[model samples]
Target: MHDPLQYEGRKVVVTGTASGMGEATAQILVDLGAQVTALDIKETSVDVETALTIDLRDPASIDASVAQIEGPVDAVFSCAGLPGPPFGELDTMLVNFVGARHFIEALIPQIVEGGSVGCISSAGALGWQEQLPILMELFARETFEDQKAWLEANQETWGWSGYLWSKYAIDAWVGWRGADLIEKGIRLNCINPGPTDTAMMPAFHELAGKEVIDSAIGPIGRYSTAIEQAWPLVMLNSTRMSYVCGEVLWTDGGFIGANSTGKQGGFGEL
Candidate 1:
C-alpha cells in the first residue's frame, strides 16, 4: 500500500469543492495531508487551507480566484460541472468545458515538476468522438468571450447538446495536450464516471429524465457514491501512480462494459 502520508505538506487545488464528488475529493486530499486551496461558487463545508468563492461560468472570477492560490501546486482537481439543459445549454458548456480549460491552462506554469492533473468527465460523454468537429471549432476560439459569441450565433445547433459536448471537449483537450503537458513533467488525465450519487444528481435526473438516470446504472445496479468517484481522481495524481499519464479512466461500474456487450442503447440515446 502507498504511504498515507505521501501528500504531507504538498499543496493542491480543487474546484467545485462545495458539494458532491468535489466535496468528497477535497476532504480526501486533506485527510491525505495535503494543504488544499479549495474553490467553489458557494462556500465549501470541507476544511481547507484556503477557500475561494469563484463562479466557474465567469472567466474573470476564475482568473481572480486562481490568482489568490500561491503554488508549486502538487495537483489540481477540475471537478466543477453543470448538468444538462434547463440549466441553459450555453451556460453548461461555459462552465463544464470552456471554464475548466481556461483554469487548467492558467495553472500550467505553477505545477511543480512531476505534478499531475485529474478532471471529471462522465460516462454520459461516450459520444465525444462523434462531436469532435463541433468541439474543435469552439476549442480554436482564443477567448471565453469569443466562445460565448459562437454559442449565441449557433445556439440552435447546440439545443440540448451542451453537457455532452462539454465533456467531449474536456476529454479531447486532455488527449490532445497530454504529450505537451508531459514535456513539462506534468501528467494530465480525466475520469468518465457513470451516474454517481451526489446532490447534483437530482438536476441530472430532472434534465435527462428519471428513466435515463435509472437506465444508466451499470451491472452493479446502483450509482457510485461520491467518495467512490473521488478515489481514482485523487489516485491519478498521487505519487504511487507516477507512470500513469494522459489516460481517461472510466469509473462507470461496468456500464461501459454493458454498452460494449450490446446490452445498452446507442450512444445517441445516452
Candidate 2:
C-alpha cells in the first residue's frame, strides 16, 4: 500500500479527475506531495482543490488550458474518456483518442526528462491493433477540425466502428511512444482496466442492464473499485516503471483471461 515514489512539490496533471480512476490517481499523487492539477468535463466542489473543467473534444479548449499551464511537469496522466452511446461512435474517438493525443502533443514538451505520460486505455482495445494503419492515415490528415470533418462525413455510416478504431489507434500509440520516449529519457504507458465501479458504472448498468454488465467483465466477479486500479497507475508513473514504455498493462482483475468478448461475463447464456 505504500508508494515509494515521492511526489512532494512535483507538478502532475491528471485528466478525467472529477471522479473514478482519474480522481483517485490525482488524489493519491497529491497525498504523496505532488502538486496536482485535475481536469474533467464536469465540475465538483470537493476532492482536490486544484481542478480544471475541460472538454477534450474541443481543440480550442485543449489549446487554451494547456497554454495556461506553466513550468516543467513531472507527469501527464491523460485519463479523460467516453464510453459510447451519448457521443455515438465518431465523437467518442474524437474525444477519447484524438483529443487525448491533442492534449499530449500540446503538453509533451513541458514534461521534463524522467517525466511520464500515462493513460487509461480499455482492455476491450485488445486485438484491435490490426487497424493501426487506418488510424495513422486518420492522424496523417491531422488537425482536429479535419478529423472532425472526416467524422461528420463518414459518421452516418462508419462512426460506430470509429470508436473502436480510435482505441486501437491509442493502443498502437503506446508502442510507438515506447521507443520515442526513451530517446527523450521520459516514459509513456497505459492501463486497461476491466469493468470498473465509477460514476459511469451506473450509467453503463442502466444502458446494458445486468444481463450485459454482469457477464461482460470483472472475471473476479465484481467491478474493480477505482482505488484498486489507482495504485498500479501511480506505480507506472513512478520510477519503478520508468523503463516500462510502449506496453499495455491489464489490471482488469482476470477479465482478459475469462471474458473473450467485452460483453459482461454472465451474458453468453442470455
Candidate 3:
C-alpha cells in the first residue's frame, strides 16, 4: 500500500513558502508528517514546523536563516525566485540563481546520504544547455557582490532577461553540479513549470501581456494548478526519485515536449 505519510519523521527545507508553489509544497510536507522549515521574504502562514524570513538577495539574511535551522536535512525545495523586469534585473539574478546555489551548498554537510534537492526552474530555461559556457562563468563568480556588478553591466534590453537568464543558469548548474552531489549520495534535480495561475501570474501578464501568457500553454490549453506543480516537486524530493539526478523535469503541461518534437504533422507525417 502506498503511504501518504511516507515522509513521516523526515526533515525538509522549502523556500518561498509565503505563497504559491512554495506554500503548497510546505503544507504538503507538513501534512505528510515531515518537519518542514519554511523560508520566505515575508512571514509564511503555512503550517510548517518552522518559518524563517529570508531575503534571498542578501547573503547575510540567507546565512542567518540557515543558522537557525537544526539539521539532518532529507530534502530541500529551492522555490524562492523573482520574475524580473520591474523587480530589478540584478536582484532577480541574485535571488533566483545565486541564492539557491548558496543555500544548497551551505546545507551539504547536513544532507544525509540519499537526500535530495529539488529546484523550481521554468520552461523558459530550455535553451540553457547551449548557453552553458557563459552561464558557467557567472556561476563561478565568488560572491553576490561580484556577480551583481557583472549583471548591472550587461542588462538586457528586454524586461524578462534577468528571469530567463537566471533560470538558464540554474538549469545549467544542475547538470554541472549533479555528479558531485550524486557522489555524496545526494541527488540534485529541477522542475520546469509552464505558465500557471498564481498571484505571480498577474505580474507575468503585466510584463509579457495576456496573449503571450495564454498562448504559451502549448497543447495543455489551460494554466496548471499549484498542486500540480507541487506534487512533482514533492516526488522529486522523496525517496521515490532516488535514481533521478541531473535531470530537468518539464511539468509544463506539454509545452516543452511539443517544442522539442516540433509540429508533429507539419512535415512528411501522414
Off by over 4 Å in 2: 1-3, 45-49, 156-158, 161-163, 259-270
Better of 1 and 2 by TM-score: 1
Which TM-score value belongs to model 3?
0.93
What digit string (tens of lDDT, one per residue) describes model 3 on residues 104-127?
888889999999999999987867
Q: Candidate 3: lDDT over CA atoms?
A: 0.83
Model 2, 120-180: lDDT tens digits are 8876676766666666666675678887777686565446555456667777787876677
lDDT of 1 by residue, 123-228 (tens): 8778677877877788788688898888888777675578877888778878877878988899999999988888878888777677878777777878899999
TM-score for predicted model 2 compared with the true structure: 0.88
Candidate 1 clashes between residue pairs 3 or more apart in a chain or in different chains: none
lDDT of each: 0.85, 0.76, 0.83
User: How much is the lDDT of residue 185 in candidate 3?
Assistant: 96
TM-score of 1: 0.94
How well does each candidate superpose onto the true structure, as a TM-score? 0.94, 0.88, 0.93
